[model samples]
Target: MGSVDLIASLNARGPTSGFTDVPDNDESLPDDFQREKAKLFNPLKVGAFNLRHRIVHAALGRSRSAFATESPLAAEYFRQRTTPGSLVISQATSEIVRTSVLNIRKAAENEGRDQNHIKIIASSTTIVAATDEEAFKKRGEYLSYVD
Candidate 1:
């Protein structure tokens, strides 16, 4: 049914509808108490990956690595946040590679459980310039290495 129709049907049910056993507008509990209790904490299939929880932890770039490769510290950092069933989004520079992804995944694996349960997403940002010349200049500056 449409949203309006659904709302009308819900409203028609009044405080106690057959839809749920919990009381409607019960002041005894907090606003979200019933809703939170009803939520499923079970594993769910998201696309091809099975997540343990619905919570997602997005990693912020902290300048942990100076090279294109994922540093040991970065791997451990990402792994520590990979709670069961939760997704971890790791932010890195443009030079992120396959090994970095694998390292993060490996670190997230827990004992007696498959490592694939914890999903890891790698994200990067691209620099944009107003003009072609500016873009090239920016790219050149980014690619240049200083020792």
Candidate 2:
């Protein structure tokens, strides 16, 4: 019979560590926690706007932009997430008409395409979840630090 090893590992296919190494009465983490608050939670004044929080919700999806025609849905989408003071950017929308924007080759091929028929750019940086938005901005800051 094989002998069993008594040394248990939390992440090694065993139970997780029951508790943190820090004492139950620990206060150090509490004090340090605020220092690490996300910029999304902080307040900032961008131009004429005095954002409630520095958290800028960058371009998301068409839901936050002109819905097919830059409708109120786009404005509502942004309004839903933004505070009175904060700024909410709508999705990166096209500034020009479809007929004028598409190149000759592509335009000729898709000239009769309806607005709804246009493809959504899935690879667009806009449109992110709350967590993703936070992490995305953080990563941007991190990358800039090295540059």
Candidate 3:
């Protein structure tokens, strides 16, 4: 079925459909809120990655590492925040961090779970400007502060 059809089907099933809790007063929803909610809660396919929802949990530096390595507690921190059909972005730059993520994935797989539902994305940042001149200017400004 198409996206609209799927949403309609979901909505028709009411709150107990297991997708999401449909509010009883759905008719009172604003048009913009309904549109945004549809996009936010719907499954998204970007390139080869199929996301269950558009909600993205970006990783923040928690200063949980010691000696430039991820601590065991980091794994627990990640585990606590992870939910089925959710994406997690890890900004860890250490090999230990990568290993922890792999271990988590393996454990989930061994339990006969849908491993695809748990997505771990290694995060990075890039600065972009509207024009080449603006980008070049920004780069120069940034470079001036470097020793």
Candidate 4:
């Protein structure tokens, strides 16, 4: 589904909690929210990259790597997040990130798109579990990151 449709489906189920800040009706979609979100989906040129969207995947300090080498999953992670005409800001400290980015570029080329088009980012995520116990457990785990 599209972003708006996906959001609508979630809103239909009622009480979205932390997932959304708005109520469930069309009237509740504030103009500012729509306008701001709409801008992100619009295209823009940043230096040499003509990005398809403003949505970026910024670098995070956290690494899933268990060793000095870039995990195979690292390339897969970028591949999953890759999109045409997007930008990615990787915080990978060394040349290891080069291999991961090249892997993503190769995947894009395989898909018949220009590999140079990608650049990436994230937004807030609320933990929603099947039960209150699971939710609190997740909350505690998330808090551990903060500490």
Best candidate (score: TM-score): 4
lDDT of 3 by residue, 21-122 (tens): 444335343334565456678888877678777766555435656654556666665554455555777665657567977798889999997777787766
* Order of the predicted models by TM-score, top scorer first: 4, 3, 1, 2
The true-versus-predicted C-alpha distance at residue 22 of model 3, in Å, is 21
Q: What is candidate 2's lDDT per residue for 37-139, written digit by digit as tens?
A: 6454466877677776554556544533444455565555555555456466544344533334465436645777564555544233453446987978877
Model 1 lDDT-worst window of ten: 7-16
Off by over 4 Å in 2: 1-32, 35-40, 63-73, 92-147
lDDT of 4: 0.62
lDDT of candidate 1 over 42-122, digit per residue (tens): 467898889854545556435556754567766765665554555787655544557776666677663545677766665
Q: Compare candidates 1 and 4 on TM-score and give the better one.
A: 4
Q: Which ten residues in a row have the lowest lDDT in candidate 4?
A: 10-19
lDDT of 2 at 33: 41
- Give TM-scores for every candidate, taking all chains together and pairing residue i with residue i: 0.36, 0.32, 0.37, 0.39
Model 4 misplaced regions, further than 4 Å:
1-37, 60-62, 94-147
lDDT winner between candidates 1 and 4: 4
Scored by Cα lDDT, where does model 3 land? 0.62
lDDT of each: 0.55, 0.46, 0.62, 0.62
